[model samples]
Target chain A: MMEITEGSHAVAEAVRLCRPQVVSAYPITPQTHIVEALADFVANGKLDAEYITVENELSALSACVGASAAGSRTYSATTSQGLLLMTEVVFNAAGMRLPIVMSIANRAVGAPLSIWNDMQDSISLRDAGWLQFYAEDNQEATDLHFLAYKVAESKEIQLPVFVCFDGFILSHTYEPIDMLLQEQVDQYLPKFDPAEKLDAKDPISFGMYATPEYYLEFRYEMDQAQKRAKDVIAKAGKEFGTMFGRDYSALTVGYLLDDAETVIVAMGSVCGTVKDAIDEMRAAGKKVGLLKIRVFRPFPSEEIAKALSKVKRVAVLDKNISLGAKGGATAIEVRDAMYGSMIPVKGYVLGLGGRDIRKKDIKEIVSLCENGIGDQFYGLRKELI
Target chain B: MTLAVGCRARPGKSRDNKTGSWRVFKPSFDHEKCSKCGMCQTLCPEGCVHEDAEGFFDPDFTYCKGCGICATECPKEAIAMNQEEK
Candidate 1:
């Protein structure tokens, strides 16, 4: 039987089920509940794991990488500033092929430092060799932990996984999250055994400096591994569906995409609101759709292009900026994918730095797509013309 | 031996050794053919291709990825892709 609980508590329970040998994380608003609940589980002896209270997010990921290297399943959590601080180690975890699953409460990285929901923090590190999954709700967030672990630990693609959820919107808000039971989780995720470990039995050098002659090959191999992960993610999601009765799309999620002429492409918690908007729009006989990007790092180019190719127009809503570029980071990737395909996809920069993302704003974005103008900014406060 | 579709046959290892095996010439200039166009010099991303003291051009294949961009983009067709044995 699955328990219906708050999103943070649900993710915490799921992590506990994964039975990580070591758990480490720093405290940050909106992402605090996940760590706090894990700490509670540790204190109560419900989880048999080493819970390390780290000084910073860098240490948090570093501890996870160390534990994973030592042949153990590890877990961690963080938000905006915390995620930003851990960026270097995040890349290291992926490059080193450590299968650590981290729950990132997606927040706006800022000058003002607001602890609210947005995709900026994680979006900034899209090329950092991690398998990223943006959860639309508490239930998806809970289930993604299991799926992320399976895919990341797969022999074909051993990389760290970032299961992203909106900061305040999904992390703080209470929702009916149906989390799997302990026995089921155990049945689904077998004990993690690293093929190559930092063990005394086989003393091998790790992260050694490579010269120009060998460095490009190593990076290319890592890129090739990530490409391999695309298939692994799909296979894992399929196995998960059979075991737990939930199907999570590996790369992209399509809502009313079939027979629709225009679509709004989004990610993270904003997708939930976008879906709601799409439902209402369809009810009024509008042929609009939504495509939520679940995996950003791998770019999901072919999948995104295939999904949006049939549509005449698309509005790519991005929460992160490339700064000095014409399009947002993800928007540029999507546009590049659709470049020769003849699909008129426009990019919109919106909801940056914890700004409120209302459903009406998404509706306006779709309406703008209908207008056929190129790229435009949405919800930007203007003083005077 | 039958090679795979895209796989090229490896030349003699000893012969390659004698002639700088798998070395990429990357086109050092023939000044007689060179117009001092600086086409190859300008297009190289690695900055390996450059003008010499005599205004003739040369490419330092030691640092090149062999991306062939310079060879592809030289307007004068001065840069030719040459292969040396390893």
Candidate 2:
């Protein structure tokens, strides 16, 4: 049924349907509504689960680490500084291969402090061993959670999954989302049964010190699981689409690329604006297209390269920059993946600290690609510099 | 190896793991001096020490790291630290 619901409530409703035995979180700007709604669900007996409001991000994730290790399906949500604070245990959860599903309301990391939208926070932790998925809208954000839990619990790829949506932009926006019935979700995602967890009757210690002999091997194994998870993601995504209507098997979706000379690549909610811009540019006879990256980690390099293999020029719009580097995280990864192809992929960093990225910005980026004048800061105010 | 091999979530499997090789010093027990007070058993870091049938405690060397905590805590001086055997 279609409902005009706040994005955060939609996500919380999805979590309720998934029936995670434990839901823990710490309140953070733009992300608090998600956990607060769930807290209400648990309190009113609407959802029979333990809803914990931990004092800080560290304890919130640490609580999830313990709950997931104890054989329960776990869910948590956080943003920006809250995410940065939990960085250690975020790594520990994946290092221990706990299948906990987390929602990252993507926001800008601050030196001066701004609670706003950006991809930097989650993008910074790209190599932390968790499967990362970026959503373009509230519907995708809600759907990705269902898909995330399925993929995380796959026997071949038992790892944590992060469902990331833009902070406030998507989290606070109200949109009509078609939600599935409870029975449909139950059929799609069965109860959490695990091959391993902390059972007192069958005690086993994890996160043990690996000697030099085994440390490298453990890391190597994490890499291999990530490589394997590529196939698992595709398979699980297909199964989900078959059961529901929205298919997401393709990691990179290209719009109007058939004979386009220039293509703009992006991720997260900004893709919505990019797509709208692409439509206007197409009407003006500009040979342009849009490529949206749905999954960031396990970085989908091969699929992305293949999608853009035919374009003449590629402009990457990154919402987060890797400081001291010439380009941002998404641009750096795209450029490296398309290396040796002679495509001249340009980097355009834009929308830091939730700066407005209008259609004019997307059009300008594409126009710069067309004129071979990109590979520079997007919408840069030279006066400010 | 496609699955995460080191990320074990189960409990009770620590018993299967061996840890004594980390030892540079091994604890040697003097049975005649032991009053069977169980201090060594209670003070063991690895939880591998056990009180045997006669109430005398012994460390399971298989998982003991030989940290010398048992010898330092033994009130009767019944335990001594020795270089680990080859």
Candidate 3:
């Protein structure tokens, strides 16, 4: 059904269609609407699920971990400080190999308190063994939830996933989304039938203490599973495209790179603005394009390298900085992917703490990249410094 | 060898570890002075102390780490922790 709806409501509807047995979350800004809509679904008999009201984000993800371990499809949502609070359980859920899917309403972490959008929250947890999918719009945000569960629950890749969309940009905005029917989602994603679960009859333990002799192998196996998820994600994404018209088969999707000299790479809802900027730049005779990264965890290194192979220079727009590093996390990884190619890769860190990133800002960044003036924070107020 | 997914294991695998090798002190049971109250068995953290056929309790050295809880909890002072020669 094609209807204009709020991003959070659309995601809530998508989650309802997936039929998670347990939905656990603590309400945080931007993410609250999704869970609130879900709570209404469970309340009005629209969805058959247990809505576990937790006290905080830690308990929220902890409840999901417990429910998922007991062979139930579980979910939770958090952002920024909330995600930081759930850090311990986050790693435990992945290490335990529970196919729990979480929604990360990407928000900026605070010291000088701010409630806004940035990729810092989920980006900081990139190495935690969970597959990350960044959404470019509300439609992709809503649709990625279905793909997240399908891939997470696959037998060969039973790892948790984070479907991250910009906090206010996607979660609080209204857009026309083609919501999936329950029947369609059911055909795409199967029931949560875990190979191992916490059944009293089975008498097995999960996440048991591993001595030095076995701990390394356990970590190695988890890494292997994460690597295997790339194939599973591609297959599931293709199947989804076959069932639904929207395909997400590529980890990184390119726009107008056929004869481009400068390529702008990014993730999340900012890609929408970047695409618009690229179109405008193309009209002005600038050979610019975009390579938006959909998946970040099992980073499409080879695919990314191949996609940007012929570009003259690369500009990576990172919404989150790596703190002490010269560039954002995405730029660091992209540079590593483009290693030995002799291509000059420039990183521009911008839009932190939800400073608006407009088409003009992207154009300015492209000009700066052309002038070889990058690897620094973009759009910083000179007076403040 | 293939490891279990998620480091999961079946119950009772703890018995194979022989944790008694970690014991520096061993609990010697003095059954002659013992009352069959089973306090030592009740207080054993490892649950390694079990009652013999005569209703007196002895610690199973195979799994007991010699924590000395049994000796301290014995109401009759019938258990003693002595330094193991090993």
Candidate 4:
């Protein structure tokens, strides 16, 4: 059914349809609506699940870890500082191999303390061993929840996942979403059947201490599982497309790259603005296009290489910076992907702390990539500096 | 051999690892001075101290790292941490 709804409520409805056995979360800005809606569902008897009202984000995820270990499909959501608070257990959940699904209403982290939309929070934890999916719009945000659970609960890939959508930009905004019916979702996602669980009938221990002799091997296996997720994501995404009409089979999706000389790479809701900018630029005879990355983790190097093989130059727009690194995280990886090909890749750190990324800014970035004048902060207030 | 997913293992696998090898000093029980109060057994961090048929507590030594917590906590000074003679 298609209806106009807030993005957080849409995500909550999608999660409800997936039939999560446990929902635990601490209410933080932007993220509060998602858990609030889920709480309403459980309270009104619309959904049969345990709603754990926790005091903080750490406990929210810790509750999820315990619930998931005990053989229940669990979920949690948070953003920015809340996500940072859950850092220790974030690594533990992935290391323990619990297939828990989390929704990250992507927000900027702080020294200055701004609760605005940015990719910094989730981007900071890219190495924490979770499959990350960035959505371009609310519809993709809603749809990705179903896809996240299916992939996370797969026997071969039992790692956790982060379905990241821009905070306030997508979460607070109302958009027309084609919400899946309970029966349709049921047909797509099976009940969570854990391969190993905390059952007293057959005792087992998880997250045991790995001595120096065994620690390296455990990490190697985790790396291998992450590499294996590419195939699992492809299969699950294809299956979702087969069932639903919208296909998300590609990791890096291209828009008008057939005869383009310059390509702009980005993730999250900014892709919507970039697309509109690209259409306008195309009319004025600028050979420009976009390659929006849906999957950020297990960084799709090979697919990215193939997609941008013909482009003369690449511009990566990052909402988060690596601080001391030469470029943003996405640019650093994109450059590595196109290393031997000798394509000039430039990275621009823009839209931090919810600074507006207007179409004019994107158009100017395209011009900067064309004129060979990037690889620095794109928009800075010189007068303020 | 395939590793268990998530480094999970069956219970009691710690038995295979003899932590006692880490002991630099062994706790020797002076049974004559012992009160049979089971203080050593209650205070053992590794739970390796147990009572025998005579009701006198002794450390299992297989899993004891000789931390000497029981020796320190014993009221009657019945347990002593003697340096292991290499």
TM-score of chain B of each: 0.58, 0.79, 0.81, 0.82
Question: What lDDT does candidate 2 reach at residue A291?
Answer: 89
Give the whole-model CA lDDT for all candidates, comma-separated.
0.80, 0.88, 0.92, 0.93
DockQ of each: 0.03, 0.30, 0.55, 0.53
Where does model 3 exceed 4 Å of error? B15-86
lDDT tens digits by residue: candidate 4, B1-86: 45789977888866555778779999999999999999889878899999999999899888899999998999999888989975
Off by over 4 Å in 1: B1-86
Instruction: Write down the TM-score for model 1.
Output: 0.81
lDDT of 4 by residue, A1-385 (tens): 9999999999999999999999999999879999999999999999999999988999999999999999999999999999999999999999999999999999999899999988999999999999999999999999999999999999888899999999999999999999999999999999999999998999999898875557798888888889999999898899999998888778889999989899999999999999999999999999999999999987999999999999999999999999999878999999999999988999999999999999999999999988898889989999998
Ranking by DockQ: 3, 4, 2, 1
Q: Which candidate is the best by TM-score?
A: 4
What DockQ does candidate 3 have relative to the true complex? 0.55
Q: How well does candidate 4 reproduce the true complex, by DockQ?
A: 0.53
Worst 10 residues of 2 chain B by lDDT: B1-10
TM-score per candidate, chains pooled: 0.81, 0.85, 0.87, 0.87
DockQ, candidate 2, comes to 0.30
Error of 1 at A88 (Å): 1.9
TM-score of chain A of 3: 0.99
C-alpha lDDT (0 to 100) for residue A99 of candidate 1: 88
Residue lDDT tens for model 2, B1-86: 22235446344544444687688899989999999888898889899888877888888888889899999999999999999767
Q: Is candidate 1 or candidate 4 better by TM-score?
A: 4
Error of 2 at A66 (Å): 0.5
